[model samples]
Target: MRRHKEHSRRLPAGPRQTGPRALSGRLPGAVAVVAAAALALAGCSGSSSSSSSASATGSPQASGSPQVSGSPQASPTPGQQNGGTQLQDAYQTVIANVLPSVVQITTGESLGSGIVYDDKGDIVTNAHVVGTATTFTVTLANSTTALDATLVGSYPDSDLAVIKLSSPPSGLKPASFGDSSKVQLGQITLAMGSPLGLTSSVTQGIVSAVGRTVTEPQGPGSPGATIGNMVQTSAAINPGNSGGALTNLDSQVIGINTLAATEPQTNGAAAPGIGFAIPASTITNIANQLIKQGKVTNSGRAALGVTARTSFNQQFQPAGAVIVSVTPGGAAASAGLQAGDVITKIDDTQVDSLNALTTALASLTPGRNVTVTYTRGGTTKTVDVSLGELGTP
Candidate 1:
């Protein structure tokens, strides 16, 4: 389907269409955000709202008449009384409890979703949803009033960010966060957000997978990075759904919807029933830091300390990572590494390309030291460097 972000910051291409990496639909004319996993993914920008069509009741009703059921109704069947009524009631209760916390975010020609993060007027959304703006216009659930908000901070590596309302809305209810560690496959979920600018919309599905090491392009024309321990779901994550809540039946925010599947080989056909989100455990930690410091000082994420790109050998096979620039006082710089060096491996893991390098590094935490193998001037070299923390204001 057609996805477009007509008036916002640049939209990144989602994962490669080969299912090795997928992009999500973002722009009014593009697919979702960039994604990786041998699984194609993208940022929200598609128009399809996924919902199971309700089956017809198969009974006729009187037109323009209030049918009063004064007569005693038949008791439900044993199966219906035990399973159907309980599930239906549970879903209704959760939806009612959670809808008030979801909100719509608009920034320069693009629209997306967010969730109320706290009673202090803080809101959590995707870094891309926050875009490059420090101020925003947010529409709360079931309300048309657009309130002013200020950006607290954003961390794109995990696709999470925080914004605060200028004036706290009275009776604001924050959604509770569930332990992502407790999330399991096949659990039911409700994806809430504004898709195509429709406020307070929801789609239902089940957890398709958990703890996936998924990566996406930071944005258009930037080096891609992984958002570790992702939550994959079958809920329809459409355009503008980014930063919205992937909630469990307990009305808890389990994840923040971020990416949708797109098949580029089919001219960017949206792959229904597949979407991704940033887990709540990561969201809580990053948001807390951003709100307090306006930047993350201890990201817990591993970084290479140098800008790098993939390079190939003479045989056109993936060889290693080529360093472009090293951060001053960073692990690579302290280790005396410089530009023009090709990294071939990290510890025992072979680094064949940029993606491989990202995967290897994501497996480690910040401050962890590992041996990096590289080739410079046709001479092989190794250096022990402590990985640095990523994330700036």
Candidate 2:
């Protein structure tokens, strides 16, 4: 099997036993792309093909002086060399325009990459990259001076974070965000990050899948899961590649690399490829909320504590969430949901699985009332339940 190589490095321990297994018994394609995207953002070694030649020139405006135009430089530096002279020139032009907006992010013991999103130096990165970090540092591309950064907001549920720099460098260029909803399978994509701490790594691949959901384990013993819409790609990802940019051919960011699947082995071992990235739509929603509020809180309908089981009866089987327990003043309790009842639907959405219930509640806010249909003693009943905030259980 041609598996993407895993770049050896240290990373914060991920939740155990999470992520989807590869269908081909190889590394999951999603895992490979996400890891590669993260690594590229973190600055790993990879290949690049040049297609454009444009130069950007500017100097800081004099104090109270008006902006002025200057001729563009026509030559590439020795460090800017690509495969061919012309290609190198084009690569340099693109790099010069894009590099300043990219940043090296260091949070706690975790290191990754991020992109500036606004002129105020607001940077966006994976939440896991800066998870609970007490301090953060941002290194501008082509410069070694590290700027102190503050964690402005974070949405752990969506795996997104935003940080602000104290004093941003001049000519800061924010990356252009694209519509991830339009991304299609087999579309070519590019990833940028620092993999294994190699600054400015870039890789290329195609979108392997879209609208895929992966569940990341929250903790070793915690029964919680982090589920999000993901964009799967075959791009190579490695350690330290977290929070990198996944862009389309137009160079617009469409996703944020997050987690990758490890190779399956008999004797506990780590394998390569199999990467995943949070889709840009989710990122934009979570990021906007993070920017407005310090945290992203979901105001969704409540669920009674339950775990359902599916069993076939002859030629048919009924699936639904079975109530295993009821919280002492929960909306379900107030709505007359009993311990033996099976939830069948919420509003117009069918609830055949726990995943379905969770997803259905995503569009609702807490304190909203909705009708729930259930089954008890082979009889169906409908009741009104007021929604509640998550974590109430």
Candidate 3:
């Protein structure tokens, strides 16, 4: 089986994860030709392709910008025309209603996308987009005036953050978030973000799938968040699209665009149409907490409540995870687990390293009881442990 690679969507100076399962960043001036295939909506005939060359601003555009060659010229039936026109009108209406809520976020060191979360000027975006910076420059849609903003809080575990504009301008339209749990397969979704620093760019696609669990590569400027119940889409999520809005035909924000899959065989190039977004439920859950509490007080993620590292056997091979320090009165401590114990498994899953243990825990729910297998003083023992919630450090 081949392991999939994931890359965060911050453009320019973003970190890349390295190793057998590492993800690489798109170079600053990398050109990605987005092929615009002429759609055959409502029985329309003939197909044409337009090549968009990547510009310095990170937007890909055709040479003439608005021109296409070999334009399809097929007459459609009355029924076909009505269906196509209605769909077209829906797309236009949704874009107009939601695009203004999307904005371009610029940290001097990086660039990404954000969504206006409320009328108070709170903006929700990916944590990596802010990336160690407390201040930012935000540019709204259809406007060139740069606004100053400051970080309210960041929850890296969920890869979500909130920033407040120093002085929120009038007529700020907050996006209406939809219930991601109701998102269905094949439902049309539009991704709105600043890809490659191209502000107000939109891409169209369908909800390819839902309930996807993706762990981002951990490194500088990367949170390495193991996000569960993620929404996968066929939308093109290029660099700078992070923290943007993925909306439905009803103009409701369904998810926050986060990262795209990278192919190791292709030298870490982005695999087109395989992007993942943090669902609206997770976004609101985390973003609201950050805005109200200045810190995440209740992270819904599970953890074993112990600090550990990978242990090696006599041959220097990874044998198991050795507990370094047990959190006092925490899950491991309450379960009679002590430091220096080597954990080998959780239930039926083998855990030979810290990362493996983390991945295993990420899949389990907090407060769930599971059998833990570990070795202490050369004696292997099994104990029942109830997992605990993972909180922001």
TM-score, per-candidate, Cα-based: 0.77, 0.60, 0.80
Give the per-residue Cα lDDT of candidate 3 at 175: 97
lDDT of 1 by residue, 201-292 (tens): 88999999997777665563223457678898999888888889999999999999888766665575667887888889888989999999
Residue 49 shift from truth in candidate 1, angstroms: 26
Prediction 3 global C-alpha lDDT: 0.84
RMSD values for the candidates in order, in angstroms, are 10.5, 14.9, 10.9
lDDT against the true structure, per candidate, is: 0.81, 0.67, 0.84
Candidate 2: residue 229 lDDT (0-100): 57
Top candidate when judged by lDDT against the true structure? 3
Q: Rank all candidate structures by their TM-score, best first, as comma-separated numbers.
A: 3, 1, 2
Give the candidate number with the greatest TM-score: 3
Poorest 10 consecutive residues by lDDT, candidate 1: 47-56
Residue-wise C-alpha lDDT for candidate 2, range 201-286, written one tens digit per residue: 87767788886556554631122334445787777666666677777766678887766665334232443445678777777766
Worst 10 residues of 2 by lDDT: 48-57
